[model samples]
Target: MDGRHSRISVLMFPWLAHGHISPFLELAKKLTKRNFHIYFCSTPVNLRPIKEKLPEKYSLSIQLVELHLPSLPELPPHYHTTNGLPPHLMPTLKKAFDMASPNFSTIVKNLRPDLLIYDFLQQWAPSIALSRNIPAVEFLPTNAAMTSFVIHLTKNPGVEFPFPEIYLRDNYAISKFQNVLESSANGIKDTERAVECCEQSSEIVLIKTFREIEAKYLDYLSELTGKKIVPVGPLVQDPVHEYDEKPGIMEWLNNKERSSTVFVSFGSEYFLSKEEMEEIAYGLEQSMVPFIWVVRFPGGAKVSLEMALPKGFLDRVGDGGMVVEGWAPQTKILEHSSIGGFSSHCGWSSVLESMKLGVPIIAMPMHLDQPINARLVEEVGMGLEVERDMNGKLKREEVAKVIREVVVEKAGESVRQKAKELKEKLISKGEEEIDEVVQEVVQLCRKKNRH
Candidate 1:
């Protein structure tokens, strides 16, 4: 059992959510090609689907490690992930996750990997790693623009963010961001957790962003935190690995004219309220644009699409629009030639997907860093935001107008072209970001060994 292998062993742990785990998995895949062996760890519930996404070649380089959270009455084993958990149980889930620190400690001690790459919320992970003489780096799956904005607000309460383009204007969004910052679990607020995680990072904080789009934000984030902000590129999932096999959805996309249709999805975690859903439904109908909308409800919720959406929605938009219940192969849909625009909630992962695939965005941010991400979307010229009222309520007219312009109007030509150019630029860069990431990570591990 002597350490003779050249491959670096890394234990990768991300938050128990599809968005966070996905980037970690993609980064793991990238590192595997550079002589890095990843022990991918997450709850059994979250790991099940990820197992299927891994190709046969990655089987040896990447090993799935089960992280068992204690079973709580409110949060059962199945609810270990944020995928289908009820909205009200979010706090319970976070508390349960905090309670699992001791369990994670055991995994770290037993595995004794040379390095640990952990998510933002779990500051204790780095603490445990340091105790075992293992260097831990924080890998934030969110973009730098939003990350810097949050940090600026926290550090300079009254100071205005230097970058005015990325800001929350609506009162509703501003209040929502404040509420999230103050929201606490286990007697600690989310902001405090983020600060601690950043402070504990070995020397560099690895983030999911590239310099081309966020060079200033990255530099400012480094200034604020005094940690080298190393971007790991987009870490986009390969469309080939997305083997869910949605033949029906793909066939529908195939029938649409090139760049004639829009794809509407609000990410896996967010479930729109009935009022919001009705407004969006009316907006989509009014836009007269062909769309593939994927609607999701909370886990175990009995509300069907017919019940959630406006009555007769299915009948009225028949053939012109497709309303899919639960899940859709989003990556596959975006890669299709027919998907001209994406009406998205601007979740970081979804934003990156649309950007990488050259699909312009009609940003309708819901909450929690999304509004900021939406602002970045517009700032980058790859998308336009659907303006909301002063109170932050979404209007059907505005939604319809934005959807039409971004997908069909001549005014949107620049944005569409910008998206296409971004896709090409990303393709040209290839794995450049990951190479820097590998160098920083390997150097950190070597430094730890020397100490």
Candidate 2:
């Protein structure tokens, strides 16, 4: 066996969202190859889907631990994740999760892991690790550019409103910016939590980005956080075979022409509002491009998608569209020869996934880090965000226009070309980021052991 990673045991605890959990799981798989023992911890329901992905071979090296979510009046034990929970009740889940610290602390003391890699939700994790003399790493699984932007904002609170010159220069205006930024004190806590975790941690800020794409941002993040920042490459997954639900998604794509269809999804955590969903439906219907759209609902939502969408929208877009309810094999769909563009929510993973497949993005960013992700996509020339009105709502015509521009029209040639070039660059770099991180981690582990 290679004496590379030196049998370091790491406890990985990501935020409750599937977006957060998936990347940790992917990292766990990669680290196990480096012979790092991983104790992958998450709530039971969140870990349920990924249980089988770990083969019989790595069972001993990569172990799954259930950290149950405490029951609250707003979020019960049955409600395991933010995936299906409504927007209003999210704070309840966070509250319950925060309350679980004693239990997590108990597990940490008992296990005495070598390192703790955690996500943004838990501000308390870094302290727990330090209290036990275990090194802690804060993991940022999104684009480095966005994280850098967040850090820049956190460090410079005096800059004040109107969203820097970059966002202001374009047709994208101030009112069209993030609601949390304009209206309330919301989202500040998460930003503070991330900075706190970074400041408290002993190791580098581990991000899911490559140097070539976001090197400047990486340096800036390091400077801002007062910690070394290590990029873990893009960490993009391809054609995930874990779930075998419907061959129909592939079948429909097979029938479409090459580079002619748009794949649409908003990741698992976000469920669009009725008006927003209807507008998107109208937009997709009007796009006139062949499309596969994945739609999700809040777990307790009583309405079916049929009743929610615009009346006659399905009948109008028939033959040219395949509207899917619930989960879709997104990677497989993106990998299809006919899949040309992605109408995405600008979730960092989805953006990277589309770019990884050389599929240009029709960026429709929703809340949180998405707006920043959208801006970065625009900056990089791989995608275009749909323009919104003064009231910050999308129009069907604009939606169709952006999709056509990204996919079929001559206007999007640069985006298409850039996407292909980016895919080549990101994919070819492969595990260079991983190799570097492994060396640093191994060194950190060995040094700690010597001490």
Top candidate, metric TM-score? 1
Candidate 1 weakest ten by summed lDDT: 1-10
lDDT agreement with native, every candidate: 0.91, 0.80
Report the lDDT of model 1 for residue 395.
96
Listed in order, each prediction's TM-score against the native is: 0.96, 0.92
RMSD of model 2, in Å? Answer: 2.8
Candidate 2 lDDT tens digits, 1-451: 2445447899999998878888888888788888789998888888787786667777888888888767766677667687777666766777778878888898899888999999976888878888878888888887776676666766887675233423432334343344334322224366667678778867677888777767777787777778889988767664668445887878788899999999999888778888788788888887799999998877777877679888988888888999899888888888889999999988888988887889999988777678778887888899998987867777788898999999999999999999999989876777777888787777776767787
Question: What is the C-alpha lDDT profile of model 1 across 281-371, one tens digit per residue?
Answer: 9999999999999998877789877788888989999899998888788888899999999999999999999889999999999988898
| Candidate 2 lDDT for residue 15 | 90
